[model samples]
Target: MAETTNGDARGASEQGAGEATNPQQFTIQKIYLKDSSVETPGAPEVFTQSWKPEARVELNTRRNTVGEGLYEVVLTVTVTATVEERTAYLCEVHQAGLFTVAGFESNATDQLLGAYCPGVLFPYAREAVSDLTGKAGFPPMTLSPVNFDALYARQRQREAASAESADDQETDNPG
Candidate 1:
């Protein structure tokens, strides 16, 4: 009986060690430029204008499950440069990456996909926008770095507040 108990204990320990060695895995499968477009409608005329262009940048991120433990995260960046209220140029870039994230809870996975993935892809998107502007006969537009973590947190807060307000309104109306 004592020998059998000792053997069982050893087997459990070995199982635990095996699990430790093969811990939860997270990896990036690939990163690529999913799509990109540059529109210089004003073109030659805009180029002739002074270099004082007002630049507007919009950024968004989306994620979808590709397969088990695999997800596709796309970071879309749109840049529009205007001069004297006329359109100078418009560029959009969709930077995407395939990530394998396993052994994480739903909330953690959400954060990873929403914030961390976009943070990783932002620099590439930024560079693409800059290159597009430079290639469009204009100086490269330097974009400031974004804090995706903070943005994600704020977005979550707003969502929660909206939900709470909706619940309050429903209770007040009771219809």
Candidate 2:
């Protein structure tokens, strides 16, 4: 006859127990503006005259592991407006988010950190920058859509090409 006891049942339960897990484990640890700055050196006087101002935007992204499974993603955007050599406004915003990312593959993690995370945080940063610029006496500067995935891919390609060139140089020298 088979043994029927609490110990056996407990052992069976332990053997058949699924891995400890929770569906709601992943979460956004926190979201904050890491850094932000807006400058309008030529504000009142700069905006007084009728001059076509040109705007330039530069963006950069960085990611760092904060904990065992937590990561921080930061997106930095710099916007500058100039009217024929005179500076109208300059704005820099750094938006950051802390996310708990467990059980994610490297590619997926990279995609989240590189593209999706930034996409989620950019709107708030844009709004803050626009408000700052407007409050600085310049017209509200609306940022355009950014294809972060394409940008990330382009950056990777450039890095790979540079590495290949470096490797080719090393191979040719063989010194």
Candidate 3:
């Protein structure tokens, strides 16, 4: 918390000229499971086979602005378990949250929504996936923690590289 020493009402606004007076803030208003599903096509047949199965995991994130300084971020996770080329089970979960973000520059805001918000939502999404797997009468499965910051950085790097390549191609062959 930051406190202003000046008591006068006008003193606050007079402190900074041509600058944003509001402090940066990021808050979570709500977190919930937007959607979830689990499938076991092999079912009883799968139970008869070996318990050793290979697991595949996928993750995605997206955001939308709903109001002034308010955003909705959704993290989707999918898991597929297979044994000997046969599908044991599949699961998908959409974990979503409403956040209030203010007093940040465009890039900072993007980082918050892209990396920080998804990080906050991941534990819930993991729990949902675990619950889904357990309810399907399979072993309790727990997903490893993800490094969203690294992922976001890599994505930004890829985008920058592609843009730079496009510019280079244009420079080489101007039409």
lDDT of 2 by residue, 1-175 (tens): 2556877987877766643443223567888999999887886788678868999999888989998878899989899999878888889999899988777777777777888888878888888788888888777888998888888789879989999999999999999
The candidate 1 region of ten consecutive residues with least summed lDDT is 19-28
lDDT of 2 at 1: 25
Model 3: per-residue Cα lDDT at residue 117 = 95
Which scores greater on TM-score, model 1 or model 3? 1
Compare the candidates by TM-score and give the number of the best one: 1
Clashing pairs in 3: none
lDDT against the true structure, each candidate: 0.91, 0.84, 0.93
Q: Across residues 1-175, which tens digit of lDDT does each residue of candidate 1 receive?
A: 9999999999999999998877667798999999998998887898777778888999999998999999999999999988999989899999999999988878988999999999999989989988987887788877899999999999999999999999999999997
Q: Candidate 1, residue 3: CA error in Å?
A: 16
What is the model-wide C-alpha lDDT for candidate 1?
Answer: 0.91
Query: By lDDT, who's the top model here?
Result: 3
Off by over 4 Å in 2: 1-26
Put the candidates in lDDT order, highest first: 3, 1, 2
CA RMSD of all predictions: 3.7, 4.0, 4.6
Candidate 1's displacement at residue 156, Å, is 0.3
- Models 1 onward score TM values of 0.88, 0.83, 0.88
